[model samples]
Target: MATLNFKHLRYFWMVAKTGSIARAAEQLHLTPQSISGQLTEFSATLDVELFRRAGRNLELTEAGRRILSYAEEIFTIGDELLEVLRDQKVKKTLPFRVGIADNVSKLIAYRLVEPALKLGEQVRLVCREGRLASLLAELSIHRLDMIIADRQMPANLNVRGYSHLLGESGLSVFGTSGLAKELSGSFPALLDNAPFLLPGEDVAIRPKLIEWLETSNLRPRIVGEFDDSALMKAFGQAGAGLFVAPTAIVDHVCEQYKVSVIGRIDAVVEHLYAITTERRLTHPAIVAISKAAREDIFGVGKD
Candidate 1:
């Protein structure tokens, strides 16, 4: 056996993470040739093939996957050591990487994650926003500590993860004061032909919302659709159209967007979940978030 080189291991880890030599090189500020050479040397030292070519892309072999797992632990410890030394603290700040589904409400995402920061542990939170599928792919590779989503992990998804239901709330419709006053007929009746801003079709709530509209026999004109909940509220505040948000933060939405609640859709419930690879939520930050959301935010016990 040959002596292992940390530099070579780091290069290999970067390649595995980005899944492309060019991308890894860009992230490391090195040339692709340099990274390739390091990987070659690292594989030679291990006496096993690390990567297999698949149509211009690199895929890790079985041996490579096993080595990469150990490499992850090694680099993670190295990061913690550096942080402890730099901060001169007995306990290093823990890094918590959470992926937020693009369609999830920004305000709700904030409320879900806020408890993690107050868990009395020094936590460094890194949030990435993207589509649920893309985030799930990253989570499968152990890149994300957890995912905050409006819906639970699909049972058909190939990834091994458990969805912990954070809480659920009814939907509330909101609009500018002028718009609210202009469409004054009744609760469900006022929504007939009303200008509305709806969530994009990609959101989990879209189907439920559509069903609710049909059930109530309301046919509001959808003037705009938004993937981002914050942007939808912004347009609604500008009187573009009425929008719906979870009732969990109804007060915050109304005050922040300067909009008045038109009505609540109790039938269209919005569920929130914390999806993780671990079946048991043991991370300090994860535990805090789960407890706070169930007890304080969602009021699960009071019911």
Candidate 2:
């Protein structure tokens, strides 16, 4: 057998992590045709079929599943080796590239992560706001050291990555006192009949909200869509429509804009998660920040 090529391992890793050739290709910035061909080449070199279709999706064959275990172990060791080599040459403060989901408020991000600067270790914290899928892609490539997400964890997350639950908070329906007053009906009935200010189409909020509404058989009439949460709250405060936001934002809007929290949408509870590549987890700086998040942010006591 020929020696295993890094290209084959890379393609296989992405496929296993994303669970879809199409999605993994998008993440890797490669054509689906190219990814498929590379995967085929990988399997051929190994003298085995790696995966087979299961309905509309693909699942690992028995041989593929066995290979996955070894692949994960190899990748982790490879990453750790690279980190050690880089550290010896650079000798700078340890750097951690972190990502946060857009649904999380800026204030929440500041509150949760700003304390990391207090740590004595030479540290660099790089933060960005984006959706879960993109953030995970950056993690897979090692562009980001970790991610903090409020929702939308991908189903095919790589085994070489790990996750920690930071906290849970419910999302609520909020709007100007005038909007709530104008509805003049029970909370459930008002939600069914009132105009709603919502995040634009293609945002994760839309699907989750729609799912929750369907369960109640209540469909809201959307008046407008805005990408900025602050602007959405402003429109809601002016009695334009009801807006969905997290508790922290709702609390802030209530005090600043005098918006009323007509009712809490119990179905929309959000969970915060910290995700990191397996190699980064063992570092002292990553360990410290993760500890802070789990304890201070999630209310989990440190071991």
Q: Against the true structure, what is each candidate's TM-score?
A: 0.77, 0.57
What stretches of model 2 exceed 4 Å from their correct place? 1-94, 156-160, 200-205, 226-231, 248-250, 253-258, 279-303
Which residue pairs in model 2 clash with each other?
Answer: none
Kindly list the per-residue Cα lDDT of model 1 for residues 92-204, writing each as its tens digit: 67889999999998988898899888877788798989999989988999989999998889888899999999999999999998888789788888999999999998889
Count clashes in each candidate, considering only residues at least 3 apart in sequence or on different chains. Answer: 0, 0
For candidate 2, what's the RMSD? 10.9
Pairs clashing within candidate 1:
none
Candidate 1 local Cα displacement, residue 183, angstroms: 1.5
Model 2 residue 14 lDDT? 81
Global lDDT scores for all candidate models: 0.91, 0.73
Question: RMSD to native for every prediction?
Answer: 5.5, 10.9
